[model samples]
Target: MVRARVLRGVDLDVPAGRLTAVVGRPEAGKTTLLNCVGGLERPDRGTVHIGADRITGLGDSALTRLRRDRIGFVFATCSLFPTLSVEQNIRIGAELAGRRTEKQWFTTVVELLGLSLLLRTRPSALTAEQRQRVACARAFLNRPDLVLADEPAGELDRMEAAALLGFLRMWVRKLGQSVLLATRDPFVAAHADRVFVLAQGRITGEVERPTVESVMAAM
Candidate 1:
């Protein structure tokens, strides 16, 4: 018989309107943590909450609707539709959430991400960083209560990654949106307001006002 546990008694809290980071190596169950919090995975034990909603025990349809209504996700890969124009890609996010697009907010997000000129372009026509920004725009356009980004800049070069993280930090602060970002990079964690270091299947430590050196030590 074999028993495998991907996460063990994981406990974490992401405060409202703040950027929180989960710092760990690639296989440290960071993604599992995010999935559980996002209600994409059920925890064997323990509660998961987003705002006031207890998500761990939610049924599938309810979880789906909750995620669509209250959370936005940005994946490590640029998960944009190759066939859709950048403008269309963003609009789809609102449409999927049963929202009417708010023009001012949409324009502001596009401009902040430096995508104002690329709205007519397809994902195939954009650079890797640009594609990621489009994905960010889509995630944030609906103004969900929480945003979960799983190694969002993992594929970018150092400069590109920094640029993307900087944009994320700035906009999250500006909009007062809560965020939980999972990454292995100490540099990335440094941008977060708080960092939790995860090892094996559990959270080992945390740092507030994180510096790269502090995160490295915790990890």
Candidate 2:
């Protein structure tokens, strides 16, 4: 059996109230890094921390609780429940955590994501952009300490991707949310406050206040 080291000596931080990004090509361990940080996968060495909590050695139950309470996730796939309305899908996270969705927060999230009119609509009835907006709304509804977005705009058209990234930036600036986004696209990485370039499971460079040209150069 051959054991593959997916991530090697990768050390980075997602600062509070800021959007950080990891830029990497496929098979460069971007998803693996996110999984480890999100506590879905345990690393062979080192530690993971979110705020004051050390998640590295936490039991499954503890990790689950921590993730539920502090972490939000947005992925390439919208992952909305086809059976549920947009509003229902957005509120499901809080429901699962045994927490009631705050009405004001819900309203704000829906409005910001332009999902207000689509609240009663099912996922299957919406456009791809709309569904992804619902996904974003759901992820933000909890106001988690950190959001992990893996290739979140991969499925969107250029304009749609720009819009989504703009909203993410707005959340960081307005709501003071922290985001860690992973992507292979320089355009995506350019939206981040700080961008880490990953190659062959290692962080090869970092660009602060990245632009597309800068990120491309780093890559």
Candidate 3:
């Protein structure tokens, strides 16, 4: 295995309004790459640009602004406040983006995520699937330019994964939001318009979907 690097000169472009799936086996440096791009971690080499803004080189405060104002993330873990209601969690994101007064945007995200019925429920009261959906809704509530999701469906069963992936596809298409998702599951990649296969921190191949059985076989 190659020794870890801060950044490994991997260049990627995620166009607007597209869902790009990044697939790699265990320990393929998926989270590292995401952290660099998301401005959560600084890279030793190379630059990460979200449109014209270079995220990798930004100072801590600037990176925080970039992430909060322009990007969103969904992790495998539920990072929402346990004490806050689902709607409040979602609303906070919008508030940060200065859109808290926009009822239309709030209602749109809630309706799209089917969270109207669960608005009052706290994170502790929700099931895993419901919590994940709320996470999704919270990420979209701010209308971010890009979203980065790591291992989003790793814990869900096949049926639930399919449903969640489909909702992500719809979210990308209808909201004009771009997404980069990292997963090991072929089913998750099946929902993306394109897939990049990573191995030992290098992109070994690219596959376009709806994938053929032969394409899935390669993974």
Best-matching candidate per TM-score: 2
Q: After superposition, how far is residue 106 of candidate 3 from its true place, in Å?
A: 0.3
Ranking by lDDT: 2, 1, 3
How many pairs collide in each candidate, listed in order?
0, 0, 0
Residue pairs of candidate 1 with colliding backbone atoms: none
TM-score, structure 2 vs. true: 0.97
Give the per-residue lDDT of model 3 (tens digit) for 22-75: 787878878888888788888787788888876766788898787887788888
lDDT assessment of candidate 1: 0.89
Clashing pairs in 3: none
Give the distance in Å from residue 163's predicted Cα in candidate 3 to where it truly belongs: 0.7
The digit string of per-residue lDDT tens for model 1 on 1-219 reads 885798997788899999999999988999999998888888888898777778878899999887887888999885898888999998886677677877888889899999999999989998889989998988898788999999998889999999999998997778898899999999999999999999999999999999999999998
Top-scoring candidate (lDDT): 2
Error of 1 at 95 (Å): 1.6
Poorest 10 consecutive residues of model 1 by lDDT?
93-102
Alpha carbon lDDT of each predicted model: 0.89, 0.91, 0.81
lDDT of 1 at 120: 97
lDDT of 3 at 179: 93
